[model samples]
Target: MTTTDADAVRLVLEGDAEAFKILVDRYYDRCLRLATHLLGAGGDAEDAVQDALLRAYRHLGAYQERDKFSAWLFRIVVNQCRTLGARRRGVQALHERAWIEQGDGEPAEEHPADREATREELQRALSRLDADQREAVVLKFAEDMTYDEMAAVTGVGVSALKMRVQRACKRLRAMLTETNHV
Candidate 1:
């Protein structure tokens, strides 16, 4: 976490309610990116992150000072993504197809063809993961959270979070390889 974020969180906890806006502003984009990757769309990810932010703001007093605020926020986002994922199970096939089609059109100048292909392949693989595994991967790679922090937020054992991340990595590697992109 950045010093600014930590300070903002500290301020919010100390009853300076407006300080929470700084935290939200700092994390919103990152949280949205992670959520979009996990939830598989801009709309769903935005919705989930917004919901998580509201919950986090409401429960700011409940947050422990010992925990990293970023990790706690990620946990809330992950849970919201899981709920969205569960609701999306039946439509996953359509969602996957749509995601592929939508993702295939990345700007060539911004991302080379090979890079775009790799990104799409990885996105598909990520979409294939179970909610927990996906959360583990996103939090580990995208947020760069430690196993202990992930465990604290996820309410799981550190070993379990590590195992989930390992499994997710292996699965992602296999999927990418199968697509001849790894």
Candidate 2:
């Protein structure tokens, strides 16, 4: 039988240290995806995810049973991403820089032409969004979390998260429309 995160946590707390691997295996992909979008994918994103997981493991004892485990873990990842963002201070992402530098060169290795173009346009729009809006949109759409879940993860009021996502969607639509029209 597959172990739930709560079960894994309980086992880990009960001195079954190896049980933590279950939690790691369960969350690795989802956490990595969240970190990648938040930090724009590179060593920084990887480091942030690693640090977040480490922090989660170390603080496991402090984790309250009342709170959802995923929310607890995601909050740590968000904090790590925010710390990395603050350090970067508006620095452009490696992918963005590459897109500029390689303008007429061969397209990125895998993404087909139209799909890649659309994705690039979306990434540019996402980058243009402020951190709060970006987080809101990513968590909402990319992670497919509901408002309540987002609130639990972010500690922001539901209304505020709604506002952020609404604004982000409007901006993304406007930007994509402009690109498509051109």
Candidate 3:
């Protein structure tokens, strides 16, 4: 019998702290995935996700039933990534690590060397994007989120998020093309 997120929340709030693990188990991988993409593959991504989870646990009382728990948690994860990213200011290396760590689910028939080169090229292209644009792109494509869902997690307007994604895609294409010529 799978307990719903709201049920788990209620259990936690009712002093059953162990019930909180249900929420963690449900969302940890997804939160870690987004954090790893935003911050990188190293301890930074792990740290961001850990901090976000702790924050969520601490502020569970603030969670409203009206909002989807996943969105609320993602908002915290994204913000935590932003805070860590700003502090480190290691965007280039971080982006590269993030891309490489995000393994492509390609078939074994693909040559490993070719796959690595493609990953590196993509990493370079993504690294060139500004923070906002990068975040928009990662959330929209990697996370497979709709604009409305993005707005809920990011606190950004839908139209602005759409523009960022559009601009980021265009810039990434241009950057990749330039690299290919070089």
Candidate 4:
């Protein structure tokens, strides 16, 4: 039986702490995907997700009923990503500069490895995007979220989120095409 997020929350508040597992089970994969895309599937990415989940668990009582549980949970995840991004700002800046200078990066050093190379190219291109554009793209395309949902998670205006997504799409396309992966 599919449990509603509100029902799960109510169960937890009613002293059934195990009920919170429903929410975590439902959202964990999605949260991990977003975190991996944003932080490139490394320890940092996993750490960001763990930190967000911990914060959500600790502050579950503070979650107001008005917002969708996902929006609130994702807000926590995004904020955690932002903090990680800031800490790794210099590394990302260097990577972005190198991406632009190299024009889609060096060759794969092996020709027949098509799918893995394509995925790697996409990951690199995604990492080169500014933090906001990366988050917007992950939310809008990868997560299939509506603009308002994205805005709720990000606390950005819908128009701004739209602009970020549009720009990200354009940049991603340009990078992929340059790499001959598109």
Candidate 5:
């Protein structure tokens, strides 16, 4: 049987520390993805996620069962990213390569070099976005989250999140167009 998140949390709180690893294992990839998009670099994102996961473990006692554990943990990740991102601003170049490379092991449907160029172009455009807008876009589209779920993680109102996404999309399109023309 599949163990639910709530069950894992209960096991952890009930003194089974190893149970916590289950929770971490389940959510680690998602947390890393969010952090990577928010922080805009794999190394920074990894550091932020490690700190966030540590903080989550330390504060596990305060976690209430009423809230979904993923949302609660994501809030921590978002906050950590914000703190790290502020510290990193101005020190990191705007055009730094920010994505983590992944291979699916399937035969290539598209030319690898062309795919890489397209990916780099998109990353450049994303890096140009305001942090808030980028977060909104990443959560909405990249992470495939609903507005309600995003609001829970980000603590931003649904309408505001919608506006950010709309603006981000418009900006990304313009930026991508400008790049293609050059």
Candidate 6:
């Protein structure tokens, strides 16, 4: 965590209620990106992140000083994403199909067609993962969080977080390979 984050968290805990905004501004986009990666686009990711922020605010007093603020915030976001993912599972198939179809019509940017295809393939593979594995992968890869930080956020042992990430990577590689994307 940065000194700024630590300072903001300390200020919030000390009852300078508005100091929480600094932490919010610092983390909000990263949290949204994590949620988007897990939830697979559209507005659900935004909703999940917002809900997580609210939950974190409400529970601020319970936060342990020993814990990294980022990890604690991530835990709240991941939980919110998991809940939203479960509720939306039934509609995901339709959403995925529509997303792919719509994507086909868009012009590719600087990235090559194959690159775009690979990215989409990875996204699909990620979406197929169980919630825990997906969360582990996103936190490790996208957030660049250490195993200890992930463990703190996930309430799992470091070994377990490593195992989850390993399994998630293996599954994603296999899925991508099967799709001829790798």
Choose the strongest candidate by TM-score.
Answer: 3
Per-residue CA lDDT of model 2 for 5-28, tens digit only, reads 888999999999899999888898
- What Cα-based lDDT does every candidate model obtain? 0.71, 0.77, 0.79, 0.76, 0.77, 0.73
Write one digit per residue (lDDT tens) for candidate 6, span 1-182: 55577788778889998988988889998898877877866788889999999999889888887877888898898789888863323112211221122224543232454665556666666667787887787777777788988888778899998999888766865775578643
Better of 3 and 6 by lDDT: 3
Instruction: Estimate, for each residue in 26-141, the C-alpha lDDT of model 3 and write its tens digit.
Output: 99999988887777567888899999999999999999999999999999999999988733333322222232221253322436567666667766667667889888888987
Model 3 residue 17 CA deviation in Å: 0.7
lDDT of model 5, residue 78:
90
Off by over 4 Å in 3: 86-113
Q: Is candidate 1 or candidate 5 better by lDDT?
A: 5
Instruction: Rank candidates by lDDT, best first.
Output: 3, 2, 5, 4, 6, 1
Q: Is candidate 2 or candidate 4 better by TM-score?
A: 2
The residue-by-residue lDDT of candidate 1 on 5-124, one tens digit each, is: 667877888889999888888889988877776776658888999999999998887888677788889889878877876333211111112123222453223235465555666667
> How well does each candidate superpose onto the true structure, as a TM-score?
0.75, 0.83, 0.86, 0.79, 0.82, 0.78
Measured by lDDT, the strongest candidate is 3
Q: What is the lDDT of residue 171 in candidate 6?
A: 80
Q: Write the per-residue lDDT of candidate 5 for residues 1-182, one digit (tens) a residue.
A: 98999898888889999998998999999998888777766588889899999999889989888888898999899999888863333212212122221234332243555766767777777777888888887787777788998999999999999999888777876776678689
Q: For residues 1-182, could you state the per-residue lDDT of candidate 4 as single tens digits?
A: 78899999988988999998899999998887777766765687779889999999889999999999999999999899888873323211112222222335553233454656555666677777788888887787677789999999999999999999878777976887787743
Judged by lDDT against the true structure, how good is candidate 6?
0.73
Candidate 1 lDDT score relative to the true structure: 0.71
Q: Please give the ranking of all candidate structures by TM-score, highest first, separated by commas.
A: 3, 2, 5, 4, 6, 1
In model 4, which runs have C-alpha deviations exceeding 4 angstroms?
A: 86-113
Give the poorly placed runs of model 2, Cα more than 4 Å off: 86-113
Instruction: List ranges where model 1 is wrong by over 4 Å.
Output: 1-15, 86-112
Q: After superposition, how far is residue 34 of candidate 4 from its true place, in Å?
A: 1.1
